[model samples]
Target: MQYLPLFVKLTDKAVLIVGGGSVALRKAGTLLSAGARLTVVAPDFATEFLQWQQQGKAELIQGYFQPALLDGKLLVIAATDNDLVNAQVYDAASARNMLVNTVDDQPKCGFIFPSIIDRSPIVIAISSFGTAPVLARRLREKLEALLPQHLGPLAELVGRFRDNVKAKITGFAARRQFWETVFNSDVVRDVQANRLPQAEQKLTALLAEPQSLAGEVYIVGTGPGDPELLTLKALQLMQQADVVVYDYLVSPEIMELVRRDAERLCVGKKAGAHSVAQQDTNQLLIDLALSGKKVCRLKGGDPFIFGRGGEEIQALLPHNIAFQVVPGVTAAAGCAAYAGIPLTHRDYAQSVQFVTGHCRPDGSEPDWHSMSRTNQTLVIYMGLMKAAHIQQQLISAGRSSAVPVAIIENGTRREQRIITGTLSQLADLVTQHDVSSPALLVIGEVVSLQQDLHWFGQRAQAAVFAQPLTHIA
Candidate 1:
């Protein structure tokens, strides 16, 4: 380690700042948050510093920098714009054997502010020894996303029980195991689910009778292709999993977020084909959890909506396995938004329906009467193979043949393709462009808005009636 990292308790400690500009103000805010008693000496000061002085949060010394100002101070921060003044403050602090930080001047800093992830009582500080501060900040952001919001509260709850646990459980090794069991119990799960009172009650009960290690299943949705759209809860669970059972629809980018050493099993299902049968997938999840593994069943889009999540969860019910459902942005909403075509608009559509064009294994057709309703947008998932049948049925059921349509391929991703045409050209558009599975068919007047509202990916290639389908760059 280039720098030995330590978090010092600054509550009620005397600290001196040698500037009063915006830079000083920023440092002052962090110090005040840590309950530091601050004295700032500067010729001019920001309004916030003056307010802090009046509020008794800090003391103001209106003068130029001097070595005497560092007297009796535990820490000193030189935040002035002038390099010479900062060096002078650093020298004075060094002479007195006090810690000093010259803002933005790393070489003169005896101490440095690290990027902090404050799930307080569980704070994480990351420093790059001033070599790569921006990279350090980005890493902090990534950690922030992965850590659950309830971690702070969870830590506080555990801290409250520390004395009781120590008194009840004997020995260091035994206590460590006890705490590990507590973390894996329903107590932590309840806390993560935002049920604090329930979590507390469960924790108390678990203290009386610690249970054996059990497995859990997390049915997580890895929103349409973009890893950034994943929920924090999903990310947390993904990192905690012992194994991940994912689908082809779950983007490769999302799979990368899973725990590094986690066992991966791809039970990927696609349109008109099953890489692994639904029954086999459900049985696999049950078997994995029965083995006491933390299994993550990762899917693309909302699992309940056409992702067969209901079937899988129902199968778990008989086995009495514990599971959680973390919904992702269903492809319809995610795709439409990226294409800049509102699923519903006052002038175009009053409501929207998400329909799947993939027929059941028995080859039974969907209810065309309801799907043919006008003035509402229809977002069809897995409709590429049946585009002609879908278009003919809707048109026969009194829907407009000329309604605008947009075929969104790989929505929300960099290589997304948007092909615009009329309903009459829906199947022709798919065939001509060779649109594949995983594409969404958006049919309604709202599709026309892509002309004016299209924003994501390359410029959409519009298909005129007789011309070859324009190549989507």
Candidate 2:
């Protein structure tokens, strides 16, 4: 490591800035904001520096930086324009064993300033160890958007209650677990929303029941691909998960959002491969929960639909394990939204139905007569293999040949592709477009509206064509 990163408390401490130009002025401003007693020594001062000196806001000595200026100072900045003068100041501070930073000279500095995001009590500093300042700043900008502005105040509130929480929870493990719950509770959410009174009340209520053991499991739905689409409750469950059992379809991006130290077990079932059988997976969940672990059964989409959540819950019920479910944007909903196809509309359709394309192990086709009615939208999940049979059955069941259909492949992903055609032509369209598995097939008049409602596809296409290979590389 080029430097050990640390944030020091400089309130009321002595700090010396050995320049009066913009660089030195910026450093002085940061130190002042931290409540440091700052003294600036230079041959000349900027207009702003002079005004600060006149207003008695800062102490300024109008002279060249000398070794004696390092006396009794906790921190020093060698920010002079002249390289030789800055080097001299760095050497002087080193001799005095004081922390020093020389502007634009990492090799000669005892400390380096990081690109910081100041949320006060919740400050985040990004550093590249003087290798790439611009990259660090860019990363900071990205983080600024992800983190809420009120996080600092929320952190302060948590800090104020730390003592009380510690006193209430005696056991070391129990205390750590209680704080984990608080971190994911509604209290933190309210604090982030700037509702201090509600947050405090919730915390007080939690403290009142310090010894209660109300363990529960949450079947959280992590939406298709994008992690941002995860519901608030799903995010909270992930943060509080003692052990997370996830599936293969759950994207790596969504898995990345889980607590860093939480145990993650892959129980994903590939078509031809199985890491863990369904029965064993169910047993593992029961064992973990019985051991008092707060387990999160994380699935790709709405767990109730095709995810075998019922079987898992059945196992838990026999053990009397408390559990709750958090619904997610199902594949049909996510694909329909991203493909710009409304599942239900006044003009296009009135009712919508979701059916699996895969038939039962008996190898019998689904009854087509019930599904062939008009004014209804049909979303077939995992239907790519049976598209031809489905079309033949629908046509035999009295559905019109001109009924529009759309196949959305890898919906919501960067590689998402949409193919539009009539039911009769869907089998052919899938062949022409080379659409793959994990696709959604939408059949009805609603598919016709997709031509005008298509927005996400156009953007995805534009992104693909606008960038050259070298740009992405």
Candidate 3:
């Protein structure tokens, strides 16, 4: 190591900063957060520095730098833009045997700041010693997503019980084992779910005796076709799950992320296909959870939005099963964004309506009269099958046949296809392009923006019908 990594205590200590611009402001903020009393000497300061001074966090001395300014200072930072002035500060501090840092000058820096992931009380610092700052920042970003937000609170909670745990558990090995069990148990789940009281009670019970195995179900949404769009909690649960129950709507790429050894069950709920019935699927989840297996019920898009997740959860109610819901980017939002079709724009649409093309068992229809209003974007999921009926009904309800529409096939996936036309040509466009399942129907004036704002896919592939769609009387 070129330089030793040390986290020093700066509480109420004096630090001299020889610059008052943006660079000085940045270093001052970090120092103040560490409880350092700052003395900043510079020709001029940023607006924020004045605010900090008013807040009694810093002492600003406006003037050119002199060696006397470093008097009685424990640490020094040269943050001025002028190279000569920065070198002067560094030389003065080095002569006085003080720890000093010259911004952007690695050789002159006695110390350097690292990229910080502040899960407070659980701080992770990544440093390249100024050689690879960008790479270090990227790594920090990755860790930020992986680390749960409840870690700080969990650490504090566990810290408070350490004395009690040491007292009860006889040996070091036993205590270690007990802690391992606590972490692997639903205590982490309870903490993550913000059920602190339940977690505390469970912890107390565990310290008293060994805990019996208990299982939990996580209804995780994998998002529309893009595995990258999966929530952090969803990914964590899928990796930790003992068994994964998934639907055909889940993309193959997403299924690849599940724990490799996990038992997989595909309860097909595709359009017009019933490989496994809904009731059987619900019973399967209930049975798997009862057998003490952490079950991840993975659904594509949001499970609650037209995914029949509500019904499945209602089934688990009588059984008194523990479950968590992780929402994903829905198809309507993801598809419309990737296709460059904004769901709502002030000039085109002021509101958006999401409806299912799949009809209910009771043979009911959506309120087309309300949905047919102008200046509103209509996004239909699984509407490919009933495109003809949708067109006729919407047109009869007063939606113009010439209203713009786009069929997003395999939306957000690599093989994604976008086909555009008018409302009258919706059924024809589907037939002509052979649009399949996993496709979304985007209708309204926003569909016109697809040509100009279309970003994720090739615009050439999206054939906009040149002729106006003929109205059906």
Candidate 4:
């Protein structure tokens, strides 16, 4: 709070810079863009400054420091390389009660340039008071990625409708509410999709007929177990949700990211333990949406990939409830990558297959013969319970019992564990290590690369099962 933040109108206002190097050139660019009348004083100037002079965008005075140069200027910058000269400019400006900034010198600066996020009409300025300039810049970068590019155009559209909305809407609360609805409605989507005409029409219709509180369902994939792996759209929907229906597969770290005030409903499912049935969960989503709540059905891994997201959305379809599906990095891909096991390698593996251990009554069982092929990787999700059967079937189907295998537990998480061995001891390894749910089984020549490529977290000692090959089941 050393300096109060303000957005000043510098259009056509006089400004002075006391340098001719790259730093000065950078400051000049910002000032010129703001329509400031720039006058730079330095004995020698860069070539770009001379170009600006020829274009009449800047006045370059070829002389040393003089107090007379500060006259009639709205703002001053001491950007010179010489400390004594910059101090002279600062003293002169301060003595005349004018604002001054001495570049890279915090104490001497009366005003400082903040890291800017320019969404044009919607500009955001972040400053660390010059103490942590790099940190402030890094924060700006993160904000830039999070802030959508459509914001500037969206702001412009809202401004155009401001007067009309004010005239039509009765009270302050009502007007604010209407604006909120407009922002959340298809107008923003239309703007993002570059359908400006449709967006305008939507806004007009919204004003013509007062908007009702509608509901939406966001079927979001939390991405394996790593919270950072969530898609931007998934994170957005999670925060906006009034209700989050999550399962046990979602990690605690990821669950911490949900909106603080959002209501949490656990319809979690684990092997042999179903907290809420599939049909009941579908009915629950329908009831919640029918009551006009923004529901985020949080799932682990890609919702469409064995997450039963299709069933839930299909149920919503008949009821005409609006919904969106956001895909995430499924366990097969995420687990393999973090464990440093490439699913496909021309020298080792040429193809990959993803399968789930648990299947519904109507679901087809995995084709063990095709899965037992050489020079390919097979990733099994929720297969810990049937590891014995898997090992026996694959071995009986002519696959080598000595083939390298990896059981990745809690993949991509901080406590992620990987146990490697040959296919002969798949069940024994699981029992010995007590591998829990949410683990992935990777069986292939690529798994041999784990000892060479495992990069994240700690890994257990590689056990190449000394016991002779025997089908447990």
Query: TM-score rank, highest first?
Result: 2, 4, 1, 3
| Candidate whose TM-score is highest | 2
Best model per lDDT:
4
Candidate 1 structure lDDT: 0.86
TM-score of candidate 4 versus the correct structure, residues matched by position:
0.61
How well is each residue in 1-473 modelled by candidate 3, as lDDT tens digits? 88898888899999999999998898898899889999999989899999989999999999999999888998999999999999999999999999999998999989998888888778888999988889999999999999999999788778878999989877644565477678989888998999998988888888889534466789998888878788889998898788999999899999999988888999988887879999999999999888767899999899999887898899888999999999889999987776778899999999999999988789988899888999999999999999999999999999999999988887777667778889999999988877889889988998887777653334422332222221111
Clashing pairs in 3: none
Relative to the true structure, candidate 3 reaches a TM of 0.58
Q: Which model is ahead, 1 or 4, in terms of lDDT? A: 4
Lowest lDDT 10-residue stretch of candidate 3: 464-473
Estimated TM-score for each candidate = 0.61, 0.71, 0.58, 0.61
Clashing pairs in 4: none
Listed per model in order, the count of residue pairs whose N, CA or C atoms clash below 3 Å is: 0, 0, 0, 0
Residue-level lDDT tens digits of model 2 in 1-473: 77888988988888899999999988888888888888999998889888888877789999998888888899999999999998898888888788899988888878888888988798888998877888998999999999888788877887888898778877654666777778779998898787999998998887787365445677888876656679999998898877899988787888889988889999967534568999999999988888777889998778898778888999899889999898888988887877778899998799998898877879877878878889999889878877898999999998888999988876665566777889999788877777766678999999888878665545544454442111000
lDDT of each: 0.86, 0.82, 0.86, 0.88
Give the lDDT of residue 136 in candidate 3: 95
lDDT per residue, candidate 4, 337-452, as tens digits? 77778999989999999888886588766789999999989999889999998999999998999999999887777666778899998999999988898889999999887777
Sorted on lDDT, best first, the list reads 4, 3, 1, 2
What is candidate 3's local distance difference test score?
Answer: 0.86
**What's the lDDT for residue 254 in model 1?**
88
